[model samples]
Target chain A: SAVISQKPSRDICQRGTSLTIQCQVDSQVTMMFWYRQQPGQSLTLIATANQGSEATYESGFVIDKFPISRPNLTFSTLTVSNMSPEDSSIYLCSAHLWEADTQYFGPGTRLTVL
Target chain B: EDKVVQSPLSLVVHEGDTVTLNCSYEVTNFRSLLWYKQEKKAPTFLFMLTSSGIEKKSGRLSSILDKKELFSILNITATQTGDSAVYLCAANLYSGAGSYQLTFGKGTKLSVIP
Candidate 1:
């Protein structure tokens, strides 16, 4: 099992500001994913982070808004730029070993933009 | 569009009752299906189903996959108040070798009352 950790578990930010959330895994993983969960809604994949490549984002999400960086196999970060009330949500990170076919998640970063 | 749909968006049940959560999906390349339980924080992985006609069980929770039907079901028996939370279903999309992303359903919110 992999233990994932994220920094600043909870934070309240103001509009037009940016917040970068960090994720670290105990073991090396080829891929790391970032997700956003809005209130009363399910999770939506923000992007997939590769160890040394540009993050691949899902439709309706742009790198300029949610830039991601994965400099190594064990760490990645997601930056929410120019935050707004609509961007207030919980951001989570996950990693896994495919042979195990299971993914473990971090506690998540709860961001409330005012 | 590739998507996952879950039924009974919200349910209120009494303790000791049995409940079944449903998830259907439509994707180009479906690699696997997963179940997760989310309380107030991050989602905890429940089960991962890759093949049909196989049942994965753990305590009061169990799940099965039907690839031909493009759907899956999660069963919770002898439910307790502790089981109240949002049950999520996700579909893994296989884009290429060592590449995948998870698309989630809207989720089923279960509330177990006394």
Candidate 2:
């Protein structure tokens, strides 16, 4: 099991503003991912943060809207750019330990775009 | 596209009662199935099942996976008020690029009344 933390536990941003949420893991992980959870909905994977490489984004999500940066094995950041009211959701960061089947999640950053 | 569906979107029960939640998935390159409990923040890992016909137990919570049926079930006995939370089910799919991602279901919101 890995411990993960996210910055800016909750934030209210104006439309068109951008916010970058940071995720820090207690241990080095082989995989890191960004996920979004809208109100009353399940989580959807936004992208997979690859160390020293461009993130692999899921369908319906683009790099221009949600950019990810994974500089190392223990840290990553997801920036929600040009936010809108529809982008108001809970953003979570998860880390998967090597050979582990389970992924541990951060405390989640709740972003409310007004 | 991977899909995960959970039954009885919401459930209400009295303390000490037992309840069961169901999850079914349709995904490619299936790797594993996981259960999580979400309260106010992030979803916490509960169980990870990689093989079928195996029951994983933790305290009063138990889960079983059926690979052939493409579904799983989580059972809670002697439920408590503290058990009120959203129970999520996710299916892990191998991307074949040395990575795996999860597809989540619209969790079952369980409210345990005292």
Candidate 3:
């Protein structure tokens, strides 16, 4: 199991503003991912953060809206650009350990857009 | 596209009662199935099943997968109030590019009343 942490545990932002969430892992990981969980809904993958490369965004999500940066193996950042009330959701970061079948998740960032 | 569906979107039960949650999946290349328990923040990993007919148990929680039937079930015995949470099921798929993704179900929200 990996120890993962996310910054800005909870925040409230005005509409049209952007909030960047930081995820840091205790050790190096092969894969890092971002996920969103809307109220009363399940988790949805936002993108796969590739180290030293562009992140892969899922369908219905655009890079312009959710830009990701993964500079190293243990850290990544996800920015929710031009947020709206509909964009209010809990953002989670997960890291996949090598040779492990499970992915460990961060505590999650709760964002509320007003 | 991979699809994962969970039955009984929400369930309510009294403490000490037993409950079972079901999850079914349809994917091109199934690699594994995972169960998670989500409370207020991030989800906690419960079990990961890759082979069929093998039961994985942890405490009072147990899970089993049926690859041929394309489904899995999680059972909790003598549930407690602290056991109240949303249980999630995810299917991992091998995408052929040496990468994988998880498709998650809507989750079964279990509320254990005292």
**Top lDDT: which candidate number?**
2
Q: List the residue pairs that clash in candidate 2.
A: none
Model 1 residue runs over 4 Å out of place are none
Whole-model Cα lDDT per candidate? 0.93, 0.94, 0.93
Query: What CA RMSD would candidate 1 show?
Result: 1.0
Off by over 4 Å in 2: none
- Across A1-114, the per-residue lDDT of candidate 1 in tens digits comes to 788999989999999999999999999999899999998889998999998789999889999999999999999999999999999999999996766777788999999999
TM-score (C-alpha, index-matched) for candidate 2: 0.98
Candidate 3 lDDT: 0.93
Q: How big is the positional error of residue B111 in model 3, measured in Å on the Cα after superposition?
A: 0.9
DockQ of each candidate relative to the true complex = 0.86, 0.94, 0.84
Instruction: Quote the lDDT for B82 in model 1.
Output: 99
C-alpha RMSD in Å of predicted model 2 compared with the true structure: 0.8
RMSD of each: 1.0, 0.8, 0.9
Which digits, one per residue and each the tens of the lDDT, describe model 3 over residues A62-98?
A: 9999999999999999999999999999999998776
Mind giving the per-residue lDDT tens digits that candidate 3 earns over B7-76? 8899999999999999999999999999999998899999999999999999999999999999999999
